[model samples]
Target chain A: MGPATQRVAGPAGPPPEPKGAIMALTQASGTRTEPRRPSRKGTLTALLFLAPFFVLFFAFTVFPVLYSCYLSLFKDKAAGLGLGAVQKVFVGGENYLRALTDPAYTSSFGNIAVYCLIYIPVMIVLSLSIALLLDSAAAKARGFFRLAFYLPNIVPGLIAAVIWLYLYTPEISPIVDAVKASGGTWDLSSTLAAYFSISNITVWMHTGYNVILFYAALQAVPKEVLEAATVDGAGPFRTAVAIKARMIAGAVSVATLFTVVGAMQLFAEPLLLKTKATAITSTWTPNMFIYDAAFDKHDFGYAAASALTFAVLIGVMSWAVTKLGSKADQ
Target chain B: MRKIRKTHVVVAVAGALSAALLAGCSSGTAPAAQSTRSGPVEITFSSWLKGSKQVVEAFNASHPDIKVTFKEVASSKDNYPALTNQVKAGNAPDVVTVEYPHVSEMATQGVLQDISKPAGDFVKSKFDPAAQSLVTFGGATWGVPLDAGVLEFFYREDLFTKYGIEVPKTWAEYEAAAAKVATADPAVRLGSTVVGDSALMAALSWQNGAKWGGVDGDSWKIDVNSQASMDAMKVHQDLFDKKLVWADDDPVLQKKQAAGQMLSVISGAWYGAALRSSFPDQAGKWRVAPLPAPTSAPATAFYGGSTFGISKNSTKADAGVKFIEWMTTDPAAISARIGGTSSTFPINTEANAAAAKTFDKAFFGGQDIYANAAAGLKTVPSGWTWTPGTPTTFSKLADGGAQVKAGKATLSQILDQAQDATVADLKNRGISIK
Candidate 1:
């Protein structure tokens, strides 16, 4: 049955009329009723709108992770000059211990942690400040600025890496020569240089995107509040700080979280730069290291172990981001 | 307001149910296609051919009784694990391409069918012995010697003529000639070797009588830290010290080699095809000659090549053998694949001769590369084998060599460390070290 019918069936339907007025008789017809239970039809319509997103989320995100976790427990074994029998041994927790104790794995983790510490705060502040300027300005060509900022994200990651690789290369790179000409040596092949160079590429590529987001959020803030603040004694800077800026703490928190996750999973930059940089070992990043161990070294058990450890680390960090960012948003 | 509240309750319940159903549907997508087909006599053939579809189509056309399919694997490193997993799961390809350096690695993995007796009748006389020996490890013949990657010097005749210099017949003369060419124009240098390619290094070292590992009776002993290898390392050190070679690692070095930026290149027989294909305009300006010897001995060794092996998990193991036997043992298949394409020298002796007859001598400035490569193929010695752990060991050695090259460590110190590391790595991998 429809929700409207169910509500009318409840007790205490009509109110008492005032005696003297005939016009009051129409007012006495007012009904009192209880809330109706939701109908099945309404629930069905709501579900129809939500189906697509949940389908993708479970397929791509959930299943493979569980499968990999299962595979991580078994070790592949070959017997007798590798020309005899082969077997899979299930050794509980052994693979994880081996991965944890591996120097390559530990070193890669340490490298990523240091990278995150340097990159996250710098990216967050720079992007936030640029976003604020772009938001606060009375620029006429807002769309042009938005497009200019988002252009880097459109460039394929591999292509960007290849272009940056050449620019960083000292052999044909005029940029390197320019640096040297000014009494500075810019070698992107060293440990410190590789980190800085990769960070620069990340900042150049992503800062524009963050700017677009911050501007969008700023535009959503109520204009009257900012106008009132400005009408009082507040200047543009003070108005932004007192009213509009406080409105984008949520956006800032979200951007900071994204930067943290991206920094931890740094792969393409390090991978492309590996041949150029002597210091960038094959295992310079955890993902690359796991890949090398599995494919290059042909040690799947070890690779799976390392990958699971990496996943766990990323999981913890991602959880922390969501928790802290959402709490701060509230 | 009551009706609205009732609708909200109804909507939320429906929403939750659909979410659960959608999640259920999505969770099973990747795992849905789990079982292999049951009806047809299906066989998969793993190959590294750039245009493998054409080959597979051609094979399928002649043999409709058995259906054959093919897949292109990324590279040896990427292919091995998947291949191993498939084999372990009882779903391996019938035929798999086993590159020369990896034949021993694969053979040791116990996923290769031993065709020793069937392969025994194949003539050692017609093939590059070194190429054949790499596949015949641990008293079992695991592959058919598909082709030989014998090294030869590809020199620019125009540059030689411009400098009024002759192609050097020995290492000392080659150096002298390189010095002369450099003197003629400081803009150009000698040659470039992939210093990072340990296989290339091992080949050169083997030509200089360097041994890696050997089986004595029932025991295997690794000899990576031998005197001959150390002596061979000196040649590379000398080249780097003199700045006679380029340091940047890329295929552009090969392009530079073509452009006469380098006078000569020490590369495999397949290098000829690359010259003809990549630099088609500079065809007649280039000539191939046999590598110059450092010593008085007339011997050489293999640098690289691909071989074919049968997967142990294949239900069509016999059919796979028959196919590889036809490709490797039959003269027509090898001749057409190698000689007709003018790609590499076929391992089949008759096929090599046929291929040699088809080669254009004008590309080499009238030097018959076929005749030269054929001669080099004979003098090539054979004493190398792959263990499952070689890739790891080689990568480690390369890193060690890089350290030595960078002056971070002395050669002796690096070698000692590499030796210890290799032994430990092999032991850990469960390879018997004697």
Candidate 2:
């Protein structure tokens, strides 16, 4: 969980724009390969130019991902004095089986599933509506509102979690005091309160970035199309919901995918709130589970096994999302 | 998958080249460290102890030939795992600090340098009997004894007087006192234990002479959730159910204790110093007593304790031993870490008088903490060996304990889960569990 993802999570107000990253990557690779087909010198020049990105991509992303999977297949075995020598035994699928069977590991996914169930719908509606409101006549100080709304997204995710954690703590938090002042008790220590407490953080950190996206999409909508609709007796609500939202369906799809992925990797917020929120455990989320395994438990094999599984799951989910989006377009 | 397979062939060649380069460095360092031909020997010490730097510096002052640098790692529970990773990565510190509960795991796993040939004599002669007893497993002393982590009760004297609660000398008395305190002030309780903190519970189990984890012939035995552990668990469960103790610790408990909302905290002497900084206002109101046990036996649990070990990867064994010898023997080193703040309890019997002389009684309302701590440390029952998978076991138990508190499971089920998880983890790590 980070503030940077806030700016990355959504699509706003207009018809979907062409997918930005894939277009850039394909164009970069295609143009380079298409040129210099027969000449060795030309090919060498192109290769030299593209070397940095490929080398970095392979080393940081490709190699580690592959190596991590390789590590999962072999577990470290202690012999003699616990540290005398560590033997690497190829346990194959044992780590995976253990992770799958583990209640802690399985429970993390359960937590995230419940998190997304609460987060996605509320996030989508609130951001989309906020963007539409800004686009309509009622929202004045448009520039100020845009900045003010997006500012929460700018707070680093860890810092944002910390800030909200303080706001959650009864002894130190003014928010808790406010609730008490209102004759209401907010026991964030409970399981349900802790879940919503973290969900609120994810929403707070993310909603504005999506708002900005929607607002930008709204701006991109053809003025003539909206004017024509209004001339035929369409109101602001109809223009926003019927004409505008469908136009930005691609953006909405992208945001939904990001939300799903973000929901999957939930870690920092829950971890930071763990002290005040007793229900949040060491293995509260999949990321936390991986951290506990690799760092806390020192079982790298089990950690890598679970990590690879989670990675494959995300990859499949993203692909399915893209496939579904394309079919919707057709 | 096929494409990545093809890429792996090319990557394999690159990996071999890197491996060769790494081997080159390792071989070079080994020979250089083999002889006294080199200048002053240097070794790295990794510990999370608060004043480890001062202790190391004191060692450096005494032994000019051995220049030791300190690398501060995480707290006790996290330190071993991090050190294990470092050792596996082949970039380990020459000297590593392991805690009481993890000593056997480290010792038997063969991760440490066998100093028997060189430093064993020094350890047998100089180390504290208890600390020495802890590190000796499977026929060798794996590390140097550092300090005592004996448990003690730090209670608010003023609160006890106000509530008219008697000083509890037994578990039953402790419960009665808790009940009295809770009735006197509904806002505060006598104490609170973190539901997820299996470390505290394990230590308490140790007081009952529970062999929760230990080596069994050629295999490891994970006997948590046994009669002894269940005995300790019963006390904690009673505390939780009766609303006599909180399910939290300092910072969270700090505010309550500072405001007299929480009356006492029964933990190791190391935590006593923490009280001064966290709640300086509560001074002169608090006092220290030996932790209560069943039947007034004066038995105490060891908590948050550590020992110093030399890594097998270190070629400088003699230098490492010399440094450890000085740290354990020198009153100056122990004195540098004197008081509860720096984690000093004079595990070295010789340093007791000096440590007691430098002891700061101001924090504990003039209570002779060192004297009482010595008495408590004297009563720690032996045979409380640790398994390498203590952290693994505790993490599960911690989560399981939370589940129990949440009404998702029962305490017995959680302990059983801890036992099963410990066994599975030990097996995974190649610790025989048959």
Candidate 3:
């Protein structure tokens, strides 16, 4: 996961050539040279260098993942008003069956589906359009625009949600007042309005970060191809749509993948909104359902089972996105 | 042979490193063992209530034999998870503040010490029967009640006079006043419903004689959807359906309250202090009344209250009980606690006079609010036992109330849903149900 993120972030820096061009060069050189195994001493040095990451990763990530899987198979049962000693009993497949059958847990997926349907396309289009405008020659102060766009992303998600919460509050918010002044009702207490309100927060916080990604990818578009399009009677709009957008298709797919994963893990924003929005229950999203199960109900076994189920769903979605993304790139 | 030796050396180094990491992570403060060798018995107290620090200081000053270390935690909603986690981790404090609804839940989960032997007699003598019932569950005294949050009606005196409305004395009259206020002005509401305050809803249900759940001869009886509970909730649902009351979480509720568009609030006795502090400009306009009941008999229930319980992990149970009894019963401790903005009605009858003397009644127009609260406290119905899955039951109730606000479901339906959810949860925990 760490190395994959680094690879994705690699294009954020200025490169002398396009990533595709660099890949082609590497591939050509790879056919000319014979692969050789490193010596035992070299391998030992590499292991020494990687040891810290491996240790921390296993302790923090791998161990908990495996432990939760083990815990999900057992449950704590206390008899007759639970005053006596509690006992941990192995209940194979029961926790998972209960999680699947529970309406509240299952409905949380429906809530996430609504959130993702609204969040993903809006985020992708808004960021891509802003990146295109920033890349155009007619746009002014590219550096300032990029920084201004990325400012909200730098603010932590919790802090950003809090700031947006203030704006969503009717008594204190000038936005709500302005809407009311114009004879419009801005009600966030309803379920559909809450979905839009939460999606608005995520979009505000993330569009700028993806704008930078798309902007960097747009920069790597071969200048000759764009110039050739311009010479062939193609206007800037046509050239941008036909040449630049196609070149950065890979970046768009990556952005969509991240946004989909993010939408599936929607928690902090809706959880904060739950304080004010009556429509958002404690189990508004899958993550919130798992959290309420573990902490509020003290049903760690059920929480673990639901969490593992959600993880598998996310894994399959991510894999499908990657497969389709690569096919689109081709 | 050389490759095997290298592999063995690598494995040994990794194992040693991981073991060291695990040891470092697991090293925490050891539980204080029985204080036989101590010059003074040391115990840790954790609370988030206002004036707790002052009370702890008073206890430490007066009691030389028992030394207390106080830790300020977050409010109850955020504190319970941390408290239970600490209990599970075996490093919980000696004494902690838990609410009435959570006492049974925590006691049943083995997070709290069964203090029957140490504090049972003292609790029976010092506290009233209603307060005593709140702490004693399943034949064991789990905690000592610090306050009795007797439900009360806080209304705008000037608004009621201007609107020519009488102070409601029954549920039927309250509904009439709600409709009258709506007719007088669509913008003004007689009161508001707190859709997310399951405690407030539970108190309302209790006033109507709803026994949510209780232990019945070693088995639990789950009855959240009783006739009384439905009748109590139907009134709120009717007001919500007619838009006569504002949803408490709506920002407009605050706006209306500040602008004098909202006429009343139904909450515990502590809310008088909150109102005075929150709306200082409307200080003289507010008055307190006993909560209107379904009948004229004047029944009430506790809205919000805290109790002190010793953690099961603490070995210093006696020291912890001494601290709790002092905090709840000692007049000096009660006075110190009321020296702040807190208006908690102490369950200890003897300490009420001390609390009233320090509490400034100038906020409620010099009305003897404590006397009014005491009158209401006497009317609280008993036999309302909070079962083991209170956290789940409350959240479901709150969610149902939310659905009511969203116009998605009625309160009666939500009550039935909560009843089913509670029964399912208790059954899942392997608690025998009748």
Candidate 4:
């Protein structure tokens, strides 16, 4: 059992030393002998575990990113009327500076930021609240409810966008009919409507996964702590706020971090929604602009540079969230 | 002891999981390269052709020496990036579909091979000069023109008969027809309403004697606010305000246009398939007619058609050109594609000869729809460039138009906004548009 069990546990799983013993001893004595160093054999085994990830990370993520950084420095040169002696010439940060100042690019970023403001907190609260409800319920069908809540997350984001787009469209949408029958002309093509429309799609598609994550974290909170809170006359709401809430902050932080990163890569929803939201441009999001630059404009070098810069921006943002979230948790 | 064993099992399983996933990904891409290696000089061709699967299939079957595998690229918006990236990675397809708008940029990038000399026979007599002109970037023919999709006005013949309205021959007559149609049915629209400064409006403007780019051809000047185009826009705005057309661009608009809800639709020759598919009940009630002539001239305009170019990086350039020539010029192949696909008109004269005999005029109330299409095909004037910056520039114009429509801004302000945006977009792409 010891050998087989250790093998099944991930290479980065907890060490053999008892966690409780180590914590207690460290607190009391304030010092302890170091555990045995991982052997060369163990290091080799660890590399075996790591090799797969590094290969893919290098091939797909690292290479393209580095290549994009290299591409950003040049503009494809055409000799005359864009028809002759073609070559690539280094233009040195020209693409970057232009992208930064471009009205379309700036506006797209602004629209997405506004969309994130509406989306992130609402998604977190609703997802966490539903997860808590499922966790606290005494019904035996809790598993079924869990599955039901998480069902929408299984739908691919593109498919979800397409479905919502159809529903938002005025002519054939049943939703549109309802709006019209009630003496309301709900046009999702309007600026505000487009914002809400895209946000609603993100919430619908992702709320379920967030619920599952929160539920898993909620289940990990010790029953004894909750029982003690109950014995102390702390009601469900009080228990949730003071005790259960703090216990699930880890999951909440993780979910929030991911949502922020994902909001930056907003493409498929806006691209599909363009068919419905005539007001919504194909380059309404940053990723969509990158798409336009590469495909529509045929400026691959500039597009590649923008993508690399975007990747860096996302990395910084993700790190900021993780750092801020961890600080908030503390 | 049990805990330690359990942890080890978890570690092993996790390791195995990653190993399995890595293996899966590597194996998936490996086959793509391997299969092409063993094929009969495999020439990979890509197209954003959702409806031309039969043509692709015919090409694959009829040509055994140069096997052409057609990969359906879902959207034109995403296709070029994938193509350019593949080219950068030294894995470009042997031949790729380059839409008219991107032909200049692609040829400018030196990524498309020169098929000018080889494709001369196919280009000169077989295809229309205007259609051939689309693929001729940098004075060398880079691709074979596949279709000539001229924008024509399609209307409901039954609706015209039912309401006692004649087919419009002039812009004023078109306006009158729209008004009459609107008066007859509250639910019905005068014609399709356009959202944004789309290519359709540009075509209408061209028909109205406005050039999007400057006439000098060296500098940028938007004719977006040119009197003629502005007049066309004003007409659109009036129709939209009158509730004669839906002021949206949703798929539901296609459904509405298919039904009798729309009296007319201004679309390319390929719209016949859409009308048939969406409203089979109204199939025998539709008819094709020339675009209502503008005051300047009695003329029609072309809309959308993609061209096929051999990638400059392709190792099998000769084989790829052979496949393109075969696909574009073969009488049997084009006829099969046009008849099977059901709306696409072959650009080649030889192919048109084959396709003309096989038309289902029953779909258009026994009218010679192809002849109507062919008549307008001659009127398709060239010099309509679909610049790579067009999407970016026009989108900004659309955004500005949205603001103007909402009364948040003036049309003049929107025009200024669009001009600045278009110039900036061109500059960003490193194209010197003054």
Best by TM-score: 3
How close is every model to the real structure, measured as TM-score?
Answer: 0.81, 0.89, 0.92, 0.82
Candidate 4 per-residue lDDT over residues B1-434, each given as its tens digit: 75566567757876786677677545523423433655477768787765456776887777776667777888886677787666665667888887665666576555677788777566766777667556754456777787766778888877788888998888778778778878888777767666454567667766666556542354434445667666656666666566666655646666676666877888888777767777778867788889888653658776677778887667676777787777776787766666644676777777676777765667788887678888888877666555435555566666766665555665445655666666665564455564
Error of 2 at A247 (Å): 2.6
lDDT, candidate 4, A76-97, per-residue tens: 7653355455578999998798
User: What docking grade applies to model 1?
Assistant: incorrect
Which candidate do you rate higher for DockQ, 1 or 3? 3
Q: Residues A78-194, candidate 2, lDDT per residue (tens digit)?
A: 753353457889998999999999988998899999989888888988998898899986679999999998999878878999888778777677888898999997765578877
lDDT of 2 by residue, B1-434 (tens): 75456457545755775576567536524433443666778888888888888888777777778889888876765676666656655667888887777776665444577777777777788765656666776667788877777888888889889888877888889888888878877888988864667777887888878878666566666798898888777867777777788765345666787778887787887776777777777778889898988766889877867678788678787888888777776777778766346536757777666677776778777888888888988888876777777776777777777676666776667888888888777776776775
Alpha carbon RMSD to native, model 1: 9.7
Looking at candidate 1 chain B, the ten consecutive residues that score lowest on lDDT are B28-37
Better of 1 and 3 by lDDT: 3
Arrange candidates by DockQ, descending: 3, 2, 4, 1
- Tens digits of per-residue lDDT for model 3, A205-258: 888988888898888888898888888999878877888887787778766775
Ranking by TM-score: 3, 2, 4, 1
Q: Chain B TM-score for each model?
A: 0.83, 0.89, 0.94, 0.82
